[model samples]
Target: MAVQANFENIASYLQQFSHDRSIPPLEKWNPDYCGEMDLVIKANGEWWHEGRPIRRQKMVDLFAKILWKEQDDYFLKTPVEKIKIQVEDAPLLISAVDQVEIDGKQYLQMTTQNQDVFVIDAEHPIYMRAFDGEMRPYVKVRYELEALVQRNVFYHLVNYGELYDEPNCTCLKLHSGDAQFTLCM
Candidate 1:
């Protein structure tokens, strides 16, 4: 069937980059732009193609692994091709958060909808970005990619935040590992 063939092609293309379940080296790939793909990542974190939602979790995970952001555009990159895709907001969403303590230090661990888990640290700092006239929380996920923290998750994060007085205003500060993030300026 056409679907099976397409899936096999994608799997084969991805096989060379699969080692220890790490992300593919997208920065090393200099593929030519192959134009647009009929794919869209909705603001609500839904992945759609050709007017229908992509219902397979494995397929979505595979696509997420190939996602790359260049300047203001998003693309799915392979060794030989780079295809643009639409992203309404961020390409991913932070769906869950957990507070973990180690050696008397607390760390916030966030999980994306794609099941990617990362600790909020210096490398993965959270920041506020204006979205729809309101400042929302976003965190750096990987190279040039960010994940918008969902409303409920943001609220959960707020529970662990503290109000710190700055020279100009009061700021909500959240800590994870040795890094501190300001939710607002």
Candidate 2:
């Protein structure tokens, strides 16, 4: 049975929430930023890649797939997936995001809070109307983007389009207008 909740005035409320919310600025960005990636070295002690370091656009595509390869299990670390939000009835899947790792070490971050101030369910309506900066919920997903947000290493939606061009891995549009994802090469 579907209950009719009055979401008639929710869109305006959501807009205010989006406009006031903020996150730390990305230090740098990569169009092809993949986390904890491995680069092979030759017997001759020369630097080498599994394949030649591809063109920038190609690298971005590859990075997205690598992260999404084990989408569910990857986030198993902090376990951010258990979510019930006011956004939709379906539970949101929050994944662990390891920004980048080099020499077997990388930085990792997990999603914490993803709330929807719309439709008014579990909070005070007065609180909903309240616009205090301190009380606003950081409702979007946050990844440990140790890599710069403006780099060309991965397919950054800020610069390029989707992260896959060959073999067709699974791709996803992230919460950010300038961010998207893919799974497996």
Candidate 3:
């Protein structure tokens, strides 16, 4: 199938980047934009190149690490080059979640497809958006990139929510690492 072939190609290409947990300092890189590429990350988290789907999970993981956003545009950046790419929605997807309590404070952590861990705290707040025709949740990742919190994960997150009344509206607030977030209004 074309999908499988694309995956193989992607896997080979990913070896160029090497698998490292540390994200490259893309913000510090001042590379010139080398025009647009035929790469696209679908809303469902599928990566495509030249209109073909990249089915390899490893390749997707590699690309996720180097992804960045400026203003409203998305790009794949490295120390030497920057290539513009298209993202149908959030650049990353929160595929799993874990919660822990530290000193009576609750901390919520999310794991992305590439195994990047992020704490849902003041520095990384969660937001909800209406996409297509339904409400989808998102969380700030590094720099200007955001990860879409998956449906099942959202359901799990609601278990810790508490209702809070404000001057104009009542919202479901949740806590993670001593940081409180408004889940819904």
Highest lDDT: give the candidate number. 1
Clashing pairs in 1: none
Better of 1 and 3 by lDDT: 1
lDDT of model 2, residue 43: 21
RMSD of each: 3.6, 23.5, 4.3
In model 3, residue pairs whose N, Cα or C atoms come closer than 3 Å (at least 3 residues apart or on different chains), thus clashing, are none
Evaluation by lDDT, superior candidate among 2 and 3 = 3
For each candidate, what TM-score against the reference? Answer: 0.84, 0.19, 0.84
By TM-score: ranked, best first: 1, 3, 2
The residue-level lDDT of candidate 2 at 39 comes to 35
lDDT of model number 3 = 0.79
Which candidate achieves the best TM-score against the true structure? 1
Name the runs in model 1 displaced over 4 angstroms. Answer: 1-21, 102-104, 164-170
Full candidate order by lDDT, most accurate first: 1, 3, 2
lDDT of 1 at 139: 93
